[model samples]
Target: MIIFGTALLAVCHLLGIFLGDLLGQALGVKTNVGGVGIAMLLLIFARIYMQRRNMLPKLTELGVEYWGALYIPVVVAMAAQQDMVSALRGGPVALLSAIAAVAVCACVIAVINRTERPQAQTDGAPILHDNPLLTEAE
Candidate 1:
């Protein structure tokens, strides 16, 4: 089962590489990141759909938890990039602008989530708090 899943994942990755190459050529874009990003986004959506349908197993159950650890290297490399690091060191104005952009995005997301959240019934059951510990106690 593990071998079959590994082969399937490898095939999907190879297909993504070819698809990305074609997209880059057609769009005149040179970065492989765009292709990889598309592939990752597709995978994320697939996982979410499978999970919603209760058809997906936990990563630990599939012995694929270690694969999740591999992302640390990619994150570290991105953080260590000189150009990205230098972008922050440009000036106080640039730094403040970046911070403000992030703050605005966070505020927008919070408002959207608040507005879209499902309302709780006022019957007898206690409402669940966002805290996991509170949920466990209930």
Candidate 2:
């Protein structure tokens, strides 16, 4: 049933937290590093594995997807509560790091856009790019 999907997610979350704690300890850190991210990855892989093996039922898949959709906003909310003001106040390193990250991401995205070829659909509908700015003016 739908509860089974929730149970699966819970199991993945617990395992992710456990693994994250272990990773943190190994890295000489006191905090759980990437626990939620690990959990999300676990959920995604689990869903894919189950779907490939025909082990997931439609109703349970729906339940898993519903919770997965909810999970993103929940994570965003949790992230919003972080002490960013203090981090920025702590040093210029934080601001610089943020800028570097954005720059690297933009470069990677540009490279991918340049190299990736668009696939032709059997239905012949124009494939929509993720960025609206890249779309043809109709």
lDDT of each: 0.59, 0.88
Error of 1 at 120 (Å): 4.6
Q: What is the C-alpha local distance difference test score of candidate 2?
A: 0.88
Query: Model 2, residue 85: what's the lDDT?
Result: 71
Return the TM-score for each candidate structure.
Answer: 0.47, 0.74
Model 2 C-alpha lDDT per residue in residues 21-40, reported as the tens digit of each score: 99899999999988889999
Which candidate should be chosen as best, given lDDT against the real structure? 2
Residue 49 in candidate 2 has what lDDT?
A: 97
Which one is best on TM-score?
2
Q: Which stretches of candidate 2 lie over 4 Å from their true place?
A: 122-138
Which residue pairs show collisions in model 2? none
Worst 10 residues of 2 by lDDT: 129-138
Q: Residue 138 of candidate 1: its Cα lDDT?
A: 67
